[model samples]
Target: MQLIIMRHGEAGRHSLDHERELTEVGRKQAANVAEKIAQSDSKPSVIWCSPYIRARQTAAIVGDILGVPVKEKSFITPDDDPGRCLDALLENKESPLMLVSHMPLVGSLTTLLSDGHRNGMPFMTAQAVVLDMPVVGPDCATLKTQFLP
Candidate 1:
């Protein structure tokens, strides 16, 4: 299975964190990343995105460009457990899955999947990493490369 992990674009500060929308620069960043994905040969079969506004917006752009459906998964939220997210993804049979999510979760999940440790990687906003995994488990995946927008 191929997994694509992406951190949502830059977002503006707001009293309600979950409702905070992406800024102009964020939108551009999302568009740039989407364009890059559209041109890539490894297109996602489906996209799983956090319900957060910024992530949802980012997923929308990518979904449009790739012509793939996006599903909102609460498990991908910033504060959610990476293990649980992995379990959920493992249940799915789709290959080349894309996940558009937030900071700590994105970084944590990447490390957990690629290196079997948390905090082994740092993910910037709008950054993406691809992993090739034979099975869903800690350290079972190989880092294929990364995309930055």
Candidate 2:
């Protein structure tokens, strides 16, 4: 399985975190990353994103560029357990999947899958990490590349 874990684009500050939306620059950043992915061989077959507005917007940009379907997932929000998210991913059979989410979860999930621990590498807004996994489990994936926008 090829997994793309992405941080949502930069978002405007809001009193309610879930209601926060992307900034204008965030849209461009997402578009830049999407264009790059669309040109690559590892384009996702489907996009699963956090229900937060920022993540949904970011996922939409990439999905439109890659001509893939986008689905909102409640479990991918910031602070959600990476292990549970991984379990949800395992239940889905989509290969070459892209997950658009927030900072801590994306980083934590990436590390959990690739390094088998939550000592995560930090991710910038609109950054993406690609991993190739023979099986989706702890320490089973190899880092393929990273895309920065």
Candidate 3:
């Protein structure tokens, strides 16, 4: 299974954290990323987003381009654990999972996925982190990638 960790694009600097929508540039960034993903062989089976407006908008833009549906998942909230969020995705049957969320957590999740991530994980705006998970047991799994996007 592949996990696509996506960060919401540039948001309004003056807007509240919970309500900020993507800036014009952010919208373009989202579209470009979406188009790039649509051209990929590893298409996302599910697109999950944080309930935050910016994240939701970003997810919707990508979802539309990829013809994949988008939904707000609470587990991906800013306060939620990135590891648990990733775990929830692994439990899902979706092969290529896309998650749109904020920072700190994206970096945190990337660390959890990469174990040590000694090289550091900094996902640029609208950047992607493609992750591969190998099945360890019927209900268990392990990440096996150091690739970036």
Give the better candidate number (1 or 3) by lDDT: 1
Candidate 1 global Cα RMSD: 1.0
How high is the lDDT of residue 34 in model 3?
83
Q: Which 10 consecutive residues of model 1 have the lowest summed lDDT?
A: 34-43
TM-score of each: 0.96, 0.98, 0.84
What's model 2's TM-score?
Answer: 0.98
lDDT of model 1, residue 7: 93
Q: What ranges in model 1 sit over 4 Å off?
A: none
Write model 2 residue lDDT over 1-149, tens digit each, in one string.
99999999999996599999999999999999999888888899999999999999999998988999999999999999999988987887998999999979998999999999998889999999899999889889999998999
lDDT of 1 by residue, 4-57 (tens): 999999899974989989888888888888888778866899999999999999
The sequence of per-residue lDDT tens digits that candidate 3 reaches over residues 1-149 is: 77788898888978678898899999999898888777766578889999999999999898988999897898886667766776686568877888899887777776666664423357788887777767512223244332222
lDDT of 2: 0.93
Better of 2 and 3 by lDDT: 2
**Lowest-sum lDDT 10-residue window in model 3:** 136-145
The local lDDT score (0 to 100) that residue 99 gets in candidate 1 is: 98
**What is the total number of backbone clashes in candidate 2?**
0
Candidate 1 yields a Cα-based lDDT of 0.89
Q: lDDT per model, in order?
A: 0.89, 0.93, 0.76
